[model samples]
Target: MRYLLPGRAAWAVSLTRTIVALVTLFSVATQLAALSVQPSTATFSLDTTTLTIPQVDYESAIYYRDGDPYPHLDFERVDRRRTVRKDHTAVVMENRYVKLTLLPEMGRVYSFVYKPTGHETLWQNDLVTVGGAANDTGWWLWIGGVEYTLPGDEHGTTWAMPWSWEIIENSSRRKAVRMRVREPGTGLEESIEIAIVSGRAFFEARICITNPTDGMVEYAHWVNPQWTPGGQNELTDRTEFIIPTDRILIDERWQENLGPSPQAWQGNPLRFIRGWSRMGDVMADGLTGGFYSAYSHDADEGIVRVFDPDKTPGVDVWTYGYHPTQIPMGSGGPNAGYVEMWGGTSRTYPDERWPLAPDASLQWTEWMYPYQRTQGLTFANEDAAINFQVTPEARRVVIGLCPSGEWRGAVELWRESVHDAADGRAPLRRWEVTADPATPFIKVVILEGLMASEFNDLRLRVGSDQDGWTIVEAEN
Candidate 1:
């Protein structure tokens, strides 16, 4: 069965949802106004002025997949009923820098838009589709944006069902919303709290998974953030999905994207193999860096996802090969290529699944930053000191550094020529700068004598004079 919600019907449904949400908000406000607050001895304040969460119905097309594990039927005529009910609500959380729209009914992010560039960071599907009777996985629903997978990887049972959400806290400094669901199959409780500040360019996602059972239960906690590097209109082949990992573990069933092959790879199975070829695909072997970035050099806009290594030990990058034409079950349009930077508890795919005993819970925080010209990120800390730069040339290049708090250290810059790329990269030319702890670490370098043609790579390392140089790790 398949159904498509056209623009007119979608607008009607959205209007209805908005009216209902406004009435509900008015009623709640009236009730809260009747309460009397006693002035306390301590200073306490809460602000909900800038925070407004309204509901709207999103229109999309949905259908079932039967031919392969994950298939997209392109046939036009719909055997199923054309008239489908708009049963889901899109909760929009907007701030100064970005706006996050979520569907509570499905516990999925409908869209994440960066307001500065008016670009969406998540790859979104315009039509809402569901699996048919033959596909009994319960996860028949598929749309773009970030979707949470709990109790197990892939789409768990909870994703197809509705989740409960509420604005837990509202303040002038920040606004926070919490969405949660309980897995019926495993009695696991998964919740995600998203918070955004007033003028910040980044947002935070705190994911918590709990095993309520008395016996030991093995589960994987992964923050699967998907984005089409070049957005929906641009070609994905021009985008680069950068994961700082030396080795990549691949699924054996993943069919190699042979250039002349008549068909593309289908389905996303949970199996892992020792090695795989990079080939024409744009993906790294495995991710070694605590952060992953996908950027379109041509467009000069991209996003960066940073995770705390102490909490999230495993990170990897998964990207569907660059296809100029429309692929089955892909994002909305032609240039829409899929790239998912996964931060999980296990190192490689299925290599290790976290074991949680009764009443045990695992939680972690993920930070996402959207930028206009951030070519790539070398390293990042929890609070600040996110170091990245654009295309590096020998003579001079502009480096973007975000250093805050007590960052009293020296940032060292190095360059490696293409000729020295075989062995290990050694520091050819060194330039160091020391800055105050309270200043922002944004610096532009002028490699006066160095020629742009001679260098193939640029490196940034941080340390004090006493400590030499060290990798940039998250420091509280």
Candidate 2:
């Protein structure tokens, strides 16, 4: 064995692992003291004498995004055995998923598609007292106070699925999130809000759903963070997609909702992609821990989300999936999360979007720690040897599909790739990780898609350089 330090640090405790699971645990303890605030348990994360999260609502808090200004899933049942845990950063109001929305059926007097005029539903619930609402239905969201109002869909339950209150205190430059019942008959609402904060990198995630009145609804949701630099968030061309390694059961109509039906012309009654591909096997990581993913916009944008069982908890990690290029606003609502059957493109479950189960919630964890890639795997440069011991079989992800085609580039890579979707073309270069001095990548390789294009022969390109224009004869 190579020479190295021995023994583990005292305060660092990783719940399940320990033979000596030896590294110094970075203390989250200074972050452990519970916070207290006004009205609700929520409090401002700032260390001030007073504790209250600044309120953000639909009306007063919307618009103006980009750069430094803005700031800003899951499934299954089986009553067998379940565990629910909430890990918070001791700061108040930073109460990640602690809030819930209690919507009522009689509320939406002005549902977008259902009304003759574009007006917001008139909410008259004893549970909710409306304050200053938006001017138009398109402006249904109300800002200022920490409360939002939503009338019921044609068939949705009044029960809430988190994200119902005003984000009293948050870092997004964009205002409050608004709930629209895309489908009238369901009891679901897609939680939609955009966070526009520049600088600082951390894995920030939120869930959106179109309420469904149909039986048990099952749909997937993904965290869309454009990765960036020191922040280790997502950057423009940086991408990555992680998935699980097991059989996947998806709605048959999902593909029809996005584009053309590969089997529709043949009388397949419009089909869905129903089975798992070998692609899942190639991207499987034994040390993935089935949770949050770490990324940088520049380093990311190249990665893809992984979907399958080996991925555990059966969650899909598709990134820049669907809209490779950003979609123009106003044309259609943010086509991000899922809603009811009428709401989501894929008509999964009983034509509705439903939560996991009564007491069972699907949770995910992503390690946003900056990584140095080697042989298709991303590892923290400062702790490569330690990471190796803890994650002996962690494989950098590659080979998967999304809105665009499957990704086939490197992680934290500085190289370039190109493609053209106009012509049904595939990438020509194989996944490669190299050190481009002009680039900041330590070493990277394509982790989501397979490259099979020839110079100038591939139809598209990704990353900052010319796609298919170059090749890595050898691995770094």
Candidate 3:
């Protein structure tokens, strides 16, 4: 069955749907205008609450080594105790589209909820246990979320420590919280400001790292997000990683289990978490785009991260692999498994460290959001995300978009060979709508009985009338 909407002949059939969509758009636009007028009144809110969680405590023996400046914990002699209830402070920021929760003590975003779908995009561990070997500190605390690491490699030095935070911005358009921590091990100060704004679906995280020492220091910074976009707090066979890269360097530990280093990303089994039989870590060698995502086909939901490739060039994927038994000890329950998407200043941990001059600082901005009904993602940028698929076998074309802000735009499809002639011709198809991040726009067009080669050379573009700009364009 072939279906088309807003076409010359099909307009009458889709009139009712068009009216309903316009009404919804009008309502949203009215609300946004009201919010803009009342600058003092905030549409978003930021507050703190106490959370009682179950955690297993451990007793550790501390020891110092000769010629070593920092003390280390003896994980070999530590004793594990029974689980107990503990109270922690949770900072929450909410808007109409999403709700974000952060734990200052953990120095990470504990939860990110997309209000429209009622799905938690970040993986949260049920139990907090302390175990596992780290690069600098031998032991690591196994509480999961979006953890920020800096001044050191492999989990950093402040993930488990307390951080000071304050409300930095509160207005009708935006609300944010800044969490700061001074690393005692490296004498560096790190702060991350997480913000949620009105009329936007994504949350922004701005990170700043300052070196106060008299001598130059080498350090590594990474934002590690453990994602379970399916909302089940687990990984499934259908979960796929979308990294726009040509090659990947598999970590040495997984070389035998997976394959050799520097393998092509396309046609590689590493794209899916289920392809691996054991735990592994892989780093993208060259990033062709500024964004990456982890999408689940079963749930039709995914997490997208947008950042500047010039500033934060590093991207890595780590998975606990498949099955309950493969889940690392002290991290989560039997059903707990997640894919960790890491973005940082350096490509690989410990192997490549960036140098920070004395009294110098580095800063960058990144946005994270949850998207749905896209089937998959092909391209993404600061303004919008696009999925353009041409299924010649099915004789169909699908266009999906998730915009960051309110947009009044037209999606146009053009046959390049015909459109590029001396006399410019009109598009083959055009659909107009008012869309925002909360309301994603998707359209499927049937080619009918046309041959596949007829549409092979095509261009898809999203043009915004309000801003007089082209949001995104893709050619297939």
lDDT by candidate, in order shown: 0.51, 0.22, 0.72
Candidate 2: what lDDT? 0.22
Q: Which parts of model 2 have CA positions greater than 4 angstroms off?
A: 1-235, 246-250, 256-289, 292-312, 317-476
The model with the greater lDDT, 1 or 3, is 3
Q: Return the TM-score for each candidate structure.
A: 0.64, 0.27, 0.84
lDDT for position 82 in model 3: 38
Cα shift from native, residue 125, model 2 (Å):
30
Q: Is candidate 2 or candidate 3 better by lDDT?
A: 3
Expressed as tens digits, the lDDT of each residue in 1-476 for candidate 2 is 00111111211223432211111111211121223222232221322122111111121223434432211100011110111121211112222212111121212111101011111111111011012111111122111111222232211222122233333335433222233333222333544332212121111223345434535544433222222222211122232222222222333334333333222111121111122111111111122333323222332222222222231232222222322222111111122211001111122212333343322333322222222222122222111100110111232322211111112343222223332333644433333433221122332223334333221121212233444332221111
Q: Per-residue lDDT of 11-63 in model 1, one digit per residue for the tens?
A: 22344444453454354333322221332322123222222222222123334
For model 3, how many clashes? 0
RMSD per prediction, one decimal? 10.7, 22.8, 13.1
Candidate 1 C-alpha error for residue 182, in Å: 1.0
Those runs of model 3 whose alpha carbons end farther than 4 Å from true positions after fitting are 1-43, 59-72, 76-81, 329-332, 417-423, 448-456, 465-476
